[model samples]
Target: MYLADGLVPYTEVFSVLDWWKVAGTRYPTLRKVARDIFAIPVTTVASESAFSTSGRILSEHRSRLTPDMVEVLMCSQDWLRNKCKGEQIM
Candidate 1:
């Protein structure tokens, strides 16, 4: 689903699609890609950014962390990124 030329034929991918929403388009290319070549269209890659921040928080020196400590750090990361409940951008 993630490769060059950006080709993902619809014949094998249909479990998670709603083609009825845009099934009728004037352009063949648009119609073909409407449900076929699915792409992540989030303008801002906040999720990726969050993960990168998390990695920076849990690197080498803090490698020997317990499960609970890891979870707490993950929560802290989400809060820092303003992605958790009651989160704020500071």
Candidate 2:
């Protein structure tokens, strides 16, 4: 069994580590739940960024561009954006 120190409220502690150190002693299960939930990764915009760039590259007027050209343009864009140094993307 854990006992609350009552010295500090759990809500007052802003940091995960700080909360664990303070409220964890009083609510170990709740702490574990919070840890697990916090460990889960949030939605990422990285893939969306890539898609957005692709959309810009293949916009309405450029829709006539062939798939091969689109692929090449996208590859070049990615390579330049990432500063990649290697053989061209096939």
Query: Which number leads on lDDT?
Result: 2
Which structure among the candidates has the greatest TM-score?
A: 2
**Residue 37 local lDDT, model 1:** 50
Deviation from truth (RMSD, Å), model 1: 13.1
Residue 38 CA displacement from its true place in model 2, Å:
0.1
Candidate 2 worst ten-residue window by lDDT: 1-10
- Candidate 2 lDDT: 0.71
Model 1 C-alpha lDDT per residue in residues 6-26, reported as the tens digit of each score: 543567767433544433343
> Looking at candidate 2, what is the lDDT of residue 15?
82
The runs of at least 3 residues in candidate 2 whose Cα sits more than 4 Å from the true structure, single-residue gaps closed, are: 1-16, 50-90
Candidate 1 lDDT (Cα, 0 to 1): 0.59
Query: Pairing residues by index, what is the TM-score of model 2?
Result: 0.35
Error of 1 at 14 (Å): 72
